[model samples]
Target: MTQTPSSSGREGGRSLKTRVKTARKRSLSSTLWLARQLNDPYVARAKREGLRSRAAYKLIEIDERWHFLKPGQRVVDLGAAPGGWSQVAARAVGAEAGRGRVLGIDLLEMEPLPGVEFKVMDFLEAEAPRQLMEWLGGKADVVLSDMAANATGHKKTDHLRIIGLVELAADFACEVLAEGGSFLAKVIQGGTEHELLARLKREFAVVRHVKPQASRADSAELYVLATGFRGAPGA
Candidate 1:
């Protein structure tokens, strides 16, 4: 990872923009991505603060604004590989050792964290939700999904895939969230999300979109938060 620096005014000061030299084996896109990651303040902050990913700050910012994830709340983190949001939930709900519990599910293995039970399983699997609920001991007070399908570099296909993932997450959340619970998921910037917002409005008292400062300005990612779940339609 070679870095080329620009003019700076202060001691050890460097331009926010980091430039990387491309190697024979690395594509220009990958090199650019590496350069961005290297210069991202949130990435550096995550390391200093002992968080798993810079994405953790996005959760922190949203929760701080909305005042959700209280102590003793049962929380579920879907597609929780890397376990950044799981860590935040565990701390918020006092899950280190108490009534509050956090369960995380993902297809990828995650390193263990205090007070978080992580299962390497696909949430789309038929039996996964039941297992997660059993670990939580009851319905969840909050459900979070940072899940996204691997980008295929085709904007249209990528948007559809993420929307589908969010819809699946919403369905799972509605089934397992206690009345008055909350749901939050990452979504791409696009038109299809309107339908999702409408569906959520039917079941939640408040629904809103949030773009945390942690999200790269150039990225088209945002989070949709719905709170005060009104319970299943027939319940």
Candidate 2:
């Protein structure tokens, strides 16, 4: 689903802390999450700016510095839900203006956006790459993944799961991205594993970890950006 750009970031205001009272049915963790959502500046900003989620700012900050998403480029957003990144990508690539295209895929259903084509398909499916390419109508200029596995509350397990997802996303990107394309995915603080990092370095001219200010300082989440993709063999 393509999303139209919302109002510019010019409108802004400070937010007051909001405390959530724990109900008899609400767990402490849920209560804390609610409170955090209520107090988060990015959350308020997203609401004010008519954006999908606070995660949108993370992409905005990263792209502002890196300048990867460009006009008339096709972009694919893996695991896009609530379409925050898709929204940003559509605007950056001018999809809404008909200059570019944006395709988003996820297992969960997403509400339609103005400049996005969305599909409900699990990225883990074996035919996913083929299907996504068919939907996109060609190779992608950029592939983005903000997917995360459900937290198991075990640091090691969580880290491994996220790395696994990133590895899969990287593999998909390699299959679908055009020459000189780019791939961006979320990873934990430990960063990509040696094998994956080495492969990415070989496939793309530049590979680095990027932390956007919009991301929570206390969160371990980090984005791995790989740019200048070398063409796939026999492509």
Clashes of each: 0, 7
* Tens digits of lDDT, candidate 1, 128-219: 77877787777899999999989998999999999999999999999899999999999999898888999999989999999987788899
> What TM-score does candidate 2 get on C-alpha atoms?
0.92
> Cα lDDT for residue 31, model 2?
100
- C-alpha local distance difference test of each model: 0.88, 0.89
In model 1, where do residues sit more than 4 Å from their true spots?
1-18
Lowest summed lDDT window (length 10), candidate 1: 1-10
Model 2 pairs in collision: 1-116, 1-117, 1-118, 2-113, 2-114, 2-115, 2-116
Score residue 143 of candidate 2 by CA lDDT. 97
Scored against the true structure, residue 110 in model 1 reaches a CA lDDT of 92
TM-score of each: 0.92, 0.92
Which model scores highest in lDDT? Answer: 2
